[model samples]
Target: MRALYQIAFLACILFSCGCSDSNPSPSDDDNVPPPSGTSSFDIITQELSNDLTIDIYVPRVENASGKYPIIYFNDGDVFKGAIASLTSYKFEASSGIEPFIMVGISAAGHRYGRYIPYNDQWIKENWSDYSPGSINYTQRLINEVIPKVEEDYPVDTKRRAIFGFSLSGLYAAWAGINYPEVFSFSASMSPSFWVADYAIFDEPRELSNTRFYFDIGTKEWNYYVPMIESLENLGFRYGKDIFYYEVPGGIHAESDWASRLHIPLGLFLNGTPEEVEGYEIIKECIPSQSTAGLVFQRLNPIVTFTNGIRYSLSTSASFQVVSGDGVVLEDGRFDTKGGSMTVEVSHGNWSEHISLNNCNN
Candidate 1:
């Protein structure tokens, strides 16, 4: 998502102009090659005034089956190399990242008209064709583009996500806020959050159900990081529900976005074996009469416990250690579930009984 200079020079947009086929070489010892995948040629879309071109990447597997998540790229034309590289690295058998299909929507010149909201006075001053009450850009994405992608691919619309850089980064945030049902996850790299005079902050909504990622270069605009921090202040769960990073020497450039794309992608698409196993254990633990008879070990800073089974409590926890007969053993905060035979936890006004297997079932 590069900023537009003017309508006449749209062809010469600064970032995300081309696609790459090369795989990024990972230096980490843990890196391994993923299954081979094919990159589809440009697909035309009739949704917007400017016919948008979408490039799709599908991973090739021996038994390629099941529905995979879909990620929409805002400035899709560029970052093809980075996308391919990360897909390979993360989807490697050991990486634990679930396989997904990527749909890249090229930013063929309407970067300003489409990505930036008309509410921003600064943007309106720069671009004459700005529409004040129109979402023609997002409309085409939802009404037209996604349906077209789904026509030819098996995509899990329930787990949809979007990513963009700079102005398109701003669009990512806007889409997530406005259409949570469509885009439940978003990554905004060096987002032009300053648009519309920080209109995003004019009573910004909490993304309780969304998984968001934000990152900016340490040396970019001075106010950018603070604005991001303000967004975080709206009560997003840091590691669980949201992720924010300040790249040490990162800049507002495609190279920076390419270099760090995997960080957000992995967080959204992949999980560590521990995390995956923990998710299963928690899912199983939720069923009635489920039990894991083992000594418990607790992991802190995020309110989690593990034995042969693991459970991570939400941030809004009010844990109670209760006896088998329903007597309260301890009534404390989220960290009160340790060394207990039975514990009742409350989160966001909902409660559940977690049976700790301190005794034989």
Candidate 2:
């Protein structure tokens, strides 16, 4: 599935490039040069007891004198390669997206501890090897990393954005929420919001000044539903101050995050939303053969928008047993009698019919 998505994403990029005649060919057009950029590695010892590596990418803007917006990434080493590729593609395409400086802060040796908040009980209880010093890590980023980067490069301080995925994604959200004065925008891809049992919602947040971009794959929808609800409860209107995308078949992987990097970049840099043309209903179920008949261990009804965003309606959608004495369980599972069963799931205006056969019989 990951390979398929990666291929599709790459194909989309190639197709878009091929369709545009305005884009000059690399061989024929010396006037239009490829997007030029330079990257350098820096070591920061002031922030932590040990040295930390920072990967920075600054795009060479031709004749543009203005300071550019900057994006700081968590798990810097993981995303360092994608940053250059994504920026080059966007720059060459002239997609109306502005280029920004990207700083990848490596997790170094203390990822689990540094990514979560200081003194997080969840980390203590779950990860036995959880190191301490998230507080120091955050302080180092604000007091040292940001300052050094700004001093070294021409950066637009007003448009600072933070990017992270997984645990780092949670860190990004926490940073934007807690330190709105520092980061104006946050993009969390497949954030592990289940951390500390959704402790992020324990207190009210003033989100008027902060913008957030969140996305999760349909497979990971169960973990993010609470965060989505909390954001809505906090008055975050989608496509307004916050953008949420539930990617169909997206998993907790770097490849998935890299594929959708353009969405948040375009949103933050160009204020453009990935346009939604329509939506399709996808029905999925995992069935296990029982002694009596067959049972569905999981029932997933996903609504995939044309824009590549997917929403899981499994828990929210209404389900009915259409035939064969099948019953929809309270836990959203399905059980069948001897022969076969069919279920119809409806959410809003979308509906899908899922059929399950009792192969055991």
Q: What residue pairs clash in candidate 2, if any at all?
A: 246-310
Top TM-score model: 2
- lDDT (Cα, tens digit) per residue for candidate 2, span 130-195: 654556778999887898889977888889999887667778888888888888899988765655
Q: Could you give candidate 1's per-residue lDDT for residues 63-116 as a string of tens digits?
A: 144787878988665444445455543345654556777878877656666777
TM of each candidate vs. truth: 0.59, 0.66
RMSD of 1: 15.0
Q: Which residue pairs clash within candidate 1?
A: 120-196
lDDT of 1 at 235: 67
lDDT of 1 at 150: 87
Candidate 2 lDDT at 160 equals 95
The superposed Cα distance between candidate 1 and the true structure at residue 231, in angstroms, equals 5.2
* Model 2 alpha-carbon drift over 4 Å, by segment: 1-50, 62-65, 118-126, 272-275, 284-361
Stretches of candidate 1 above 4 Å error? 1-50, 62-65, 78-90, 126-129, 132-134, 224-235, 271-361
lDDT of 1 at 97: 56
